[model samples]
Target: MKINWGHLNHDSAVAVQSVLETEYNFRTTVTKLFLQKLTDEMHDHLEDVQFDICPLTKCFKISPATPEPVHAALKEIMSHHLPKYKEYTYQA
Candidate 1:
């Protein structure tokens, strides 16, 4: 969540030493959020969406508190993009 939020607020002016990191785009994240399997209904993407009204009658939206799937997808993407395979010996 922190990483995603950082994407929304990227600051090249104050970067930490020598780290090679690019903030992921927020738009892509939104697209992924609504990606549904062929079996899923059109509204399945909205399963986690929460809406509410403030005291002033202004409408607002809140994302799901649980982002495990997003985190898992990130882990999967990182592993595939930057694989670290250990040396192995195969014995038959």
Candidate 2:
């Protein structure tokens, strides 16, 4: 079974995910990441770097202009965004 990890909007975002996967086994081989909109809010967070989707996405024909700033913004969110739900704790 393959599961989607949502969309990645920038090259740096792809690089970051690749690093995470190679270094941490963050996802199963069957997992996939999809790219969606690169909004202004998302772009504002990036420091200043241009980006594009990976060949895989392009080969499949998914391409877009994702500026560096948006990548940075995504990174910031990944760096500081809180978990939607808390981990479970056991009481003795």
Candidate 3:
């Protein structure tokens, strides 16, 4: 019997299920009985990997931006003049 599998390298989520899925490929559909075979292999192979789903989200949150005085004035007028949800908290 030939087993078709993909290379499961450099996992970052570090989740046991994700790692096992990478290692098992389509085995879960082939046979649930032997999924443990691949899971055992994953247990021995977990390693550090850079995780970056939204790496930009971090920079955007941490970095500050200053608008020019003219732009700020326009924003102020538009925010106050425009219709907004009652739930909006920022000052116009």
The best candidate in terms of lDDT: 2
Question: For every model shown, what is its TM-score relative to the native structure?
Answer: 0.24, 0.22, 0.18
lDDT for each residue of candidate 1 in 1-92, tens digit (9 for 90 to 100) = 22112121334544421122222333244335445321244344334432221212121122234244543443344344334311112111
Which pairs of residues collide in candidate 3?
A: none
* Candidate 3 residue lDDT tens string, 1-92: 12222233444565445544533542332233223333554333222111111121111110012223422432343344433311222221
Q: Which sequence of candidate numbers ranks them by lDDT, best first?
A: 2, 1, 3
Task: Answer with 1 or 2, whichever has the higher lDDT.
Answer: 2
User: Order the candidates by TM-score, highest first — what do you get?
Assistant: 1, 2, 3
The TM-score between candidate 3 and the true structure equals 0.18
Superior by lDDT: candidate 2 or candidate 3: 2
Candidate 2 structure lDDT = 0.32
Consecutive 10-residue window with the lowest summed lDDT within model 1: 83-92
Judge candidate 1 against the unseen true structure and give its global Cα lDDT, from 0 to 1.
0.31
After TM-score superposition, what is the CA distance of residue 32 in candidate 2 from its true location, in Å?
18
Candidate number with the higher lDDT (1 or 3): 1
Clash counts per candidate, in order, are 0, 6, 0
lDDT of 2 by residue, 28-88 (tens): 2112121233355643433333222222332111112334555444444433432321121
